[model samples]
Target chain A: MTDLPRPSAPPVSAPTPGGSNLDVLKHQFQQIWQVLAALALIYMVFFVLSEPFRSFDTLLSIFGQAAILAILACGTTVVLISGGLDLSVGSIFAVVGVIVGIVLAEYRLPVPVAVLIGLAAGALMGALNGTIQVLTKVPAFIVTLGGLTAYKGIAEILASGRDLSRFPENFQVLGSGYLVPMGIMFGVALLTGLFLTKTRLGNHAFAIGGNEEVARLSGVNVRKSRIYYYMIGGVLAATAAILEVSKLNFAMPARGQSYELFAIAAVVIGGTSLFGGRGGVGKTLIGMLIMQTIIVGLSYLGVGTSVQRIAIGIIIILAVYWDVWRRPAR
Target chain B: MTQADTATPLLRARGITKHYGAVVALDAVDLDLHAGEVLGVVGDNGAGKSTLIKALTGAISKTAGTVEMDGKDIQITTPTEAKAAGIETVYQDLALVNELSITKNMYLGREIVRDTLFGHLFGTLDFAKMDTEIRALFQKLDIRITDIYREAEAFSGGQRQAVALAKTVMFGKRIAILDEPTAALGVRESKMAMDLVRSLKDHGLSVIMITHNMQHVMNYCDRVMVLRLGRLAAVRDVADVDGDTLVGLITGAAEDKVA
Candidate 1:
């Protein structure tokens, strides 16, 4: 603060919404802290409110799988931040799981190679979505919607109506059996968090979603950035697939079914602006935790999954509404 | 290459033209801008005013034209090139990522990389350097942004524009072209924007402003260029043309004798 650069010229005033104003940028740490505080308060309220109705330990336990949600949310957040959506994430997750299982079980590939293949497959699929959409100027909705169907088909083909299980002991490590998966999940989250907050790529991702035209004008290599975003998203979904396979120890085509929705929900709950130009992977992590806790706790109480689905729907809607309310009018 | 006039016109466009399919959007326009001058461009809708500026800034490519900076003809085929040539454009919408802090937006494309030895997952991001530089730039602009790192979406409209202007200047441009910088602004805000425009001249950069408000042309401009029907009507000294005469030129009531 003391080494502030002196004004070379007289100060130019900021333009106000209603008048010529110098739109003040208040402290960011303060704003983020408030958001984090609100998030904590909401969680406390959610726990306290739900306590009379359920067990808290169950919620914590189910949250372990919320890592899947967190991963998907990470992908979804990238798409959303880039001013688009990726309904294909769920399908991509499914496809990647099936492919990994096939390459490892039938083709007898090395575990490390399988991981690479699965991740690469996911990235390629995502790149396809981005390329076709940007190249054709098609709305991402349509493009990804097509991807949703196409990828699901690929998953079905790979699984061939049989859940591909009986993998190497190492593969078993990812599921509920070992702590490595948990560690990896946290590691992935940390990496993602750093990618979104610390890297130049992450900064560009946020910038593109905030104002794409402005991003392009600023020389952000918009097309390349979009492609990069989707690639990151693809890798996350595939990684989530590996984690899911480890937990379930099954490469069922349907294993990752509906995963994209969960990820989107987590991202929204984490406080990412659906409108783009706002959000971070860290927020998505919070969102995933919230979801995992809800699913686990509610299930332990034997609340039907239908009810959980309804709860998820409500959570998504309310989360978006909250975001809508807090957001400044564009 | 048209040699840059030693007097150093901040920007010069010779025989600039752009055509879209069968239509001619901009046709053979020549513009000269001098350093430390606020050149006002007034034109009716579809008069190619925006097109000309867009061509200069590389927001759009001209079908034909030579752009000169500092006495040499150069190709400005992209926004990056235009910026590198010391030309900047800030659109009316302000074109800022409101989710970004002023400092972040100011250095959106050009980020200072930090040493990675201590840098974490995203790389060695030097938030400290960014924060310090951003705060300094904001202070210099008298921008009252309290935090240099908050998202831009939280700011008001005028504040967004300020961020945009700061972005252009921070990038180090010699010519700044603003499109309808004050269109949606209130009287006070518009006056403040004009003040910034005037300040650009003091900073030794030429300014080209596109505005619908004739009052601004009369008040803030050193010279006014009026356009009609996709062509130049007249380039008049501010001292000579009244608001009425300028409007007449815009509406084609008067013709430019030079053309």
Candidate 2:
């Protein structure tokens, strides 16, 4: 074997001018090709299924359905890049909705005040998660697992097992209106993209995810950065909660149950590795679109809810498996 | 050379000792570094080379030691503090985020942020400036990276070493501690790294390089420090000593002869 001539080597030659630039473009295309293919496939399926699925109203409905999940996924993407998971995001979303409903219905507060309170409560919840993880040095999976159940219980207690409904019409517009939730999602996506690519904190998050010891050696405030990442996740989940409550014109204690599953699924499907250190907000948006399209497409095709759930489950596994497969084998 | 340059050392470590419970890793090691000089540290396995570097760089807490710079005592209790004191270390592992671009890794902690309202509130990184700085630094070091945006994972071993060295050169102000900087490189890369060491000296920076390769010591270092069994065995100028003599000192044969 040692004496054998190599057979896999390419012919030695000078690369053409602009070859490096072409290689860069090809590398980038390779990264997004799968997601792009998935998008095309979903669009084709919808187009073939019904003429109405291609209508503007149906597209808007899809965006509206995806808006909340998109916001949640944006935050989750940041946390995932920092090499952590937040199972509590779904719980936090439910709890934030409950908090907002309490402020608006029980306390009869102004909408902005209630919204602010909800956002703050969500951030505080996230901060608690971050603090506990850092102080205890426990794995985030365990910490957020505890939070997932505990926060749900808290939300149940807070909402008193009633669906809080009858919001003011202006508040209702924030969710059910044609453009508002979509606008919010677009804004969140843009900001998240900028944060990950053009900010120190964002770079630090990826650096920590890449190698925590190396990040520490580089003088990154690892604990503080993790706390901030969780806080961002928390706030975004709250924002999604607000939109969700408004869209339905009601807040239920069980709202957003298993929403973390959807958010994580979107993130993984977006090509972001669950192991961290890769992926971006743009990819996550594509993941969100793919997910919403699948759901809406299923309903339009008259697939039962159970079948839709099964489909989503299979897709999540396939997406993650493909991600792992695409990576260089260690 | 100035009078003060000859009179006072750039950095001095006096009675630096580290103990891990019942195990003594380093025993009262003392060393001095002068401006514009390369100091090589050599020892056998478990000879406390890495331990000494860690203590100096504040990667671990030393049991007892006092490190001085410019005749003033400095405390390096953490990596951040070591950085604040203008001391940088290129560990054998390189401490680079393999997923990040070279510019990002170079400015990982000390990122350049503009002071606009958006930047101040949101902490936006000035990537253009960082890219320019990286390009300038690479030019200065004669390291051609076709794409500055490429991640460290894409770099070859020697190229990675060069990137790490460039990172150190970018932020290191006082002294650099390189732990076997060229130990993992091939012939060309080793020569590149050795040339970097020599360049650091030319730029009036002090360097402490730890390696088992005696050839590097003989060819690049101004003085060589030998450690045997966690103790300082000998220190000699490269002019006064050869590779065989350094190996003997390292293995305790020369120590027996001296005694």
Candidate 3:
């Protein structure tokens, strides 16, 4: 609970100098460590809920699946940080799957060629969303809602209402391959986290979502930041789709149905405020793992599909409810 | 005690006029602010004070006017352009992001980068360095606070004012316009803000303060400029006027200065 906040503040210690200050810093680190350690302890207690499915392989599988959601959530974390919502991301993921499938299976394109097309299409879609939102000065929610429908429709049209199957051997290997895609997901998450905490654009993203008008007055390029952030989201969502087809060896326009909810739920559960500003990719990774663990563990326990679905809804409601602590004093 | 009175004023707006749709917001306004001086702007609500400040900050474009920096006339159509030209404005809201730490809020849009254009990651905000620099800046101005890393929401109003001013100076601003720094603040906080204003003059930064408070004009500012409706009322040295005479000027009945 306490570890939810990163070091947004300077290290606080009495100015006691050269060697002793190291001791003071050590002491501060101890406090943060304790808080994080406490959160880990709480997570273990929940394993009682997932006890029946507790196995080495089960845990590894949970982590692998969590890795994908974590990467997607990291991207959403950036958008939320910049004060945007990409509802069309779900549809974009489905469209990417269909595109990658068709190119490799029907057109017999190279894997890299299909990937480039998939990534380009995603970024282009996200740019359109950002452009419309900025030009109309409307809320991103409205623009992306329209995008949600249009993008999904585009995915369906590409599939012609049929499932895509029989990808080339290399394509199948990339999707369900044990190490590569899983490794890619983790690497993306780590890179995204580093980018959020380190880069200039990351700083601008936080500032834009924090108080956009103030940021504009302070010389932060709001529009440029917006476009970059949405583009990042586009790439992440589309990558998730490519990985999905790579694993499953098939794709349909419905491949990404409801995935937007999972990504959003992960970010929201991770403590990223939908109000924009604050929160980072690291916390979102934790949120994603937590969600994946809950869902995957429940499935391993042979929980009914309907029950699992209801629990996901309940879990999201519960997560948002905890934000009562974050509200400003009345 | 200071060289600002005769120093080439950092910015001067002459014969400025702006209108929105049909209503004139600023009318033929002329004002100048110099290093080592606090030029206090006073008027009632809707008296063109805010509109003039927006124009000065380049939040609004001048329909017909010229803004000068070091005697060179120029055009600024945006706040970013104003900043590039070394003019900064701290609005009444203070504009600090409440959720971010003080240094994070201070460098909100102007982070200090290291070897790469990409600044530090989370751990790289250079807590020790930013803390040291901010501490020295505050100490030089004789302001003290417990936490420089706490959220701005936790700071006292006076401390936040100091932070806002520090942010402006840190951005290398040559001219700063403060919109009612003391308006909703308590007496002690108000005094703190005024002391910071005094320190800006001491550091050779020009400041233009907008306020309706007469005591601020008498105690701190070198020159008092009055705005009546959408026009220039007058600009005078504090030595040449009293509170009653200044109020009369705002009301438009005072004909001439009684020597």
Candidate 4:
């Protein structure tokens, strides 16, 4: 007994429960400074290299171009944070776009009704993915991979070898000006951020991602919450599809190909864990901007698409490597 | 300690049986807990100690059983139902989410949301209120954790144990169940855990603790229950049992004298 060490108090220098607001702000800045630094550095490099990249319009256009991907990434961020994946979001985007096109062009329905139908279809597809995964006890990676293929087929069948176009002028307004889409992107980001930080479902998402067994023991409704996360993912994908179709005035069955992987890459680049349990919508937003900046900046510098793709691939690997490197040893 | 026998047990379980396929994990075990008494449950590996606790806590379904609080039968089919009945369990794994802050882990399933419309609509957690309450709880219990906002992963083993025990104290209104609370702790931390158990008893909560350590049973528990091969082998007042005798009972070397 005498040889046993005594219990000691935590160090006095440790932060207290009543830490001041300044300390909190400082801690937040510490958490995100790396991403902010990277964004600034990339913007500076582009601004220095290309004359066209210096214009305010280039910045606005970057935001506009980022809108669709940003919207898709928001859903992926939530799903990834919950320790799940949805490879079918790209397909969901195409399916929803085709559905909206048919409703407006062929059926001549109101824009709001078409939009509602598209959103509902997307949510239903997402729910189906979650239900199958949960019920069959299949891994989400496999379940959504199957969804990716199946939903694409469904979209093609719905489109019937014809492009749906010629929407009412009001519908086109959603994607016409840079301000509208940009505003929509920011609005989606803000809402998603609030959902992650403020809601019970958001907190539960982190808990479930951190440890599914622990969350279950803590009385979290794991199955229902998981289904809800996938639903949100689906709805966001649908929203992006609707915006894209409005901008293009045509819905192609091939639309949104590979967007799922792109959105996931952007989320991973933003520092969201690919393994789940730690991330935010704000981080995803920054990640989306980083990718958009590189794509637009490279094109302005007369770089080819193949080069841009290679650069993005390298950045994704580096971002993931950084995540792994910074993780404290188990 | 003598009063424990005569005062109707705070919690009682009868004929608790659990079967998984062809294996009988728990063979109609019985348990009794008195108010303000620490009851230690001991058994060898695969001896149904955890099975019994899970059955009681509704972590696992029982093949057959009845659990009563103050002699009134209560329905417990899920962990939430068990919690609603004022029964809290600190599982062997501690069940703490490492990435979440102490405040979040403390109120993981049952958070205190704000009174505003946003809270009502979105179920917005009131972090300020939760922080204040948990801070006050730690102070009242004399637990030494200062940063309640730090993630659970950042804490030492003993500190995490403290957080888990504090959670039990906060919500275990009538009964607190702990499974191997000190298995991962050092000698000093083991003593600290026992001290916290004493505090829980002092706070007038009945406790059902499972441990492999004979010293803890002798030092802290008023009475001990031993399970052997999924069956309740013996129950003895700690004063009447020595460490060797208890080990014999656990290993099937000694006769079941008290039964």
How do the residues A1-330 of candidate 1 rate in per-residue lDDT, one tens digit apiece?
011112332233432231112323234344456446755665565566565424645444555666666776778887898787888988889999989988878888989999999999989998888888879989888998899989999888867856488888877776663356556767887877777777788888888887788788877888887887888888888998888876777787776677777788888887888888777777777787777666655765678889988988998999899889986443
What's the i-RMS of each model? 11.2, 7.3, 9.4, 6.5
Error of 1 at A243 (Å): 1.2
lDDT of 2 by residue, A1-330 (tens): 011112332111211122255766776677788897998799798889877788888888888888899999999999999999999999999999999987777787889998999999999999999999999999999999999999999999998956588887778888876589999999999999899988999999889998888888888999999999999999999999999988888898889988888999999988898988988988888898888888888888888889988988898899999878876443
Q: Which ranges in model 4 have alpha carbons more than 4 Å from their true place?
A: A1-18, A161-163, B1-7, B255-259
lDDT of 1 by residue, B5-61 (tens): 346575778888889998988888888898778889989999999898988888888
- Which segments of candidate 3 are over 4 A away from where they belong? A1-46, A49-51, A161-163, A177-182, A300-302, B1-10, B116-132, B145-147, B251-259
The full ranking of all candidates by TM-score, starting with the best, is 4, 2, 3, 1
Ranking by DockQ: 4, 1, 2, 3
lDDT ranking from best candidate downward? 4, 2, 1, 3
Model 2 quality (TM-score): 0.92
Q: DockQ: which is higher, 2 or 4?
A: 4
| Stretch of 10 with least lDDT, candidate 3 chain A | A1-10
CAPRI verdict on model 3? acceptable
Candidate 2 clashes between residue pairs 3 or more apart in a chain or in different chains: none
Docking class of 1: acceptable
- Residue A183 in model 4: lDDT: 91
Per-candidate DockQ values are 0.35, 0.33, 0.28, 0.41
Sliding window of 10 residues with minimal summed lDDT for model 3 chain B: B115-124
